[model samples]
Target: MRLHEYEAEEIFSKYGINVPQGGLAKTTQEAVQIATNIGVPVVLKSQVLVGGRGKAGGVKIIDNLNDVERVVAEILKSEIKGFKPEGVLVLKKIEIKKEIYLGITIERTSGIPIIMLCSEGGVDIEEVAHRNPEKIFKLSVDTLQNLYSFQIINMVKKIGLTGKTLIGVVNTVFKLYQVFKKYDGLIAEINPLVITENHEIFCVDAVLEVDDSALFRHPELNKRKLNNMSERDKRLMEKGATFVKLDGNIGIICSGAGLAMTTMDLIKDYPSLAPANFLETGGGITSELMFDCMELVLEQPGLKAVLINLYGGINPIHEGAKGIAKIIREKKVNIPIVAKALGNRQEETWKTLEEAGVYVIKESETQKAVKFLSELLGVKK
Candidate 1:
């Protein structure tokens, strides 16, 4: 789960990391109050889940009460990356002499947590890595051992930071590592970790993503949930259907998570099939659940087609086919549906779907099924 900047900063401050004084505001009046409390010359940042808030005009600098009202009103009335800005974070603006980037993320290839630091900050790290790979320095930590002091010093030297700034950076890096380990975080990043003219370092911006699977262990983190879930997601959960929204035209429903993800990936390879959602109907799917899943997929405004990939593992293919047929008969769905039925009771499953006038692909190969679905959906190859 991704955290908003204010939430991440709160966690960072708990670990002895220095952050600017800030408070959250939900309205223009609240923003004005926060600015007044923190004193003027405050930074008003829109609190949204997505990035590039500054580019999206979600961030502003206000020197007084009038500017605070104007900036807050403008931000609250706009949306960034499709999410409507409902609140703003009011923080004390600070003078910066230099900027740097610091981040820690799990490395799949190394099988360990990796710390990434760069002198070129306030820009997307990925872009920096692609355009100037030499500017970024990376260090992988052994999960069994704590981050070493020498390693921190080496990173500071590699970034070309010296003197008091280097000492402060080293301490902040160790504290960040502690926060990552304690919270079971997937990513903890501070973009533009700035140095003031007086040689004090403070994390001016923060972003953290926690491991959803490990949330049960962190009750405090769980309580900080921002209720930013999408409307489609809430409806799917209420209807007892496992659904994950995606930017595509083809709606997919499968018996297992692995198979559903693979189906989406394969569809992407075809250049024609665009998966709308990742719907996994865990074993023994009832007709009602199947119907609910289909209805949820259809509710997507841009959905163009439906792909049903069922492999009999623990789920009986015959029962699943019956459910699909029932949904078609009852819902009167007009959209094209392509079904690939294989394993347990395949023959019966095919017969049931065929009887309902649904296009049943009899191929065992995923690529062939993808091609057929693409054609049916009018996806150009």
Candidate 2:
């Protein structure tokens, strides 16, 4: 699960990573009070999970008193990518002489934790890497072992650091790694991990995505749902279904992870066709549950089309078809839904979809299905 910047900053401090002084505020008055107490030169950040906050007017620096209340009020009411702010973080803005990026994430294929660092920070590291790969440095780390001093020195050198600055960065990286391992994090990152004119380094921004699978070991996180999940998501989770909303137009429903992922990948490759979510109905889900799942998928924001990619080797297509039919019979769906189901009773399944007026695509013609959906949406790539 992903964490808000404030929550991640709290975790950073707990792991001994220095961060700017700040507190979360839920109201304009609270923000004004906090800013008053902290003095001027504070930054107001939107607590939403989506990116491009700066461009969205979710981030503002208050160097003057007249703009403090106005900026905070604007931010508190702002929406970024269809997500309204829960609140604004009133953080002490730090003076930066330089910005650095440091992050540790698992290498998907290798299953090894890798430390990625770049002196070119403050901006999106992925964009930096895409435009200039040589600027980003990477090393795969064995989390089971302690970081060696030599390894820390190597990172410092690659980022062009020396003296006290090098020592501070080394310590920061060490603590950041500790936070990563302790939380079973998929990503523990500090963007614009800044260096002040005073020569002190502080993590000005943080983004942490924890391993949801490992949350069982961190019971507190499970109990609280990381305080990030919406009530709808929490209820869905209790039903053994997984749904993650994304900024896309196509709502995806499938039985297994691999099929759903592959379908999503194919759709992404197509111009103007993006998967809205990863909604896995799981194996042996009842028709009633499938009905509910589709209902939920239909309600998804920014959804223009639905794609049901099903393989019925173990999850019989007949039963899956029954669920799809249930949705057709009960729900009033305006969006076009296309499905590709195979196994158990292919003929019967195709008949079911045809009867429900659901379009069917051959399992071998996956790319064709994606193309059909893209054209059906009438959107530009």
Candidate 3:
């Protein structure tokens, strides 16, 4: 689950990472109070889960106390990317001598945690990496073992740091890594980790995302409401499934993220058809889980068709197919339900799906399965 900036900063601070003094405010009065207490020119940042807040007028500097109410009220009323502000973060603005980028995340291809540092900061790291690939320094870390201080010092030195400043930055990296490891984080980022004219380093912005599957281990996080998660996503998460809702009529249920994405892309090959959701069941599958998935997706309004793409592998997909069959019978679903069941016990899986009146595709190619569903739904070019 992704956290708001304030939440991330709180986690950072708790781990002994230097962060600017700030507090979360839910109203204009609270914002004004925070600014008054700081007694310095402060920045009011809208607390939303999405990015582009700075460009969207969700961030403002309050040099005068008189303007705090108006600025806070204006930001609170404005919506960014269809998401309203849950609150505003009031922080004392600092004079920055330098801005640096530091982040740690799992590298998908290598399946290793990669720590990245860049001299440039306060902007999208992707944009920087694409424009100036040489500027970004990377070190892939094995999370199973300890991250040595020398490793961080060596990487930081390449960026031209020296003396106390270098030591401060190195220490911050250590603290940030601790936060990442302790929280079961998918992403622990500090954009614009700043050095003030006073010669102190503070994480000016933070982005922490904990793995949803690992939430059960952190009860404090599991009970908190996630602003970025939709109700459907939450329901699926609770059921040990993950679903990404989309804006189309085809409901997609697949066994992997890659396959679900591929199915969505192929479904878009037909001009009038698009995926309604991307549902991934991961490795663990059961008849009851499949039944639950079908029931959830079928509840979506305007879903004209359902597509189930599965690869048996080590999973007893034939048994899971029983759940789909059960739900179909119970709901009396009439929409075109097309399934492409491949791999071990493919015949048994096909039989169970077919018995529930689902159109089973024998082709191993996903494109053909999508084309068949498109035609069945009478999708126009």
Number of colliding residue pairs in each model: 0, 0, 0
Taking the tens digit of each residue's C-alpha lDDT, what string does model 2 give over 1-381? 777898899989998888988789999888888888888899999998777889978898889866878888888777787788988999888988999899999998899999999988888887898898998988889767877878978977987898888889989998988889889998999998898877799999999988877889888777766466656566566667777667688899987877788889989886667888888876575566677678778876677789987777766677668878888777767678898887767788889888898889866667777777777776545
TM-score, cand. 2? 0.89
lDDT of 3 by residue, 110-160 (tens): 888888999998989989988998889998888678999999999999889
Where does model 2 exceed 4 Å of error? 226-232, 298-300, 316-332, 352-357, 375-381
Ranking of models by TM-score: 2, 1, 3
Candidate 1, superposed: residue stretches over 4 Å from native = 224-312, 316-381
Residues forming the 10-long window of minimal summed lDDT in candidate 3: 225-234
lDDT of 3 at 215: 81
**lDDT of candidate 2 vs native?**
0.83
Best by lDDT: 3
What TM-score goes with each of the models? 0.75, 0.89, 0.72
Compared with the true structure, all predictions reach lDDT values of 0.83, 0.83, 0.87
Task: Flag clash pairs in model 2.
Answer: none
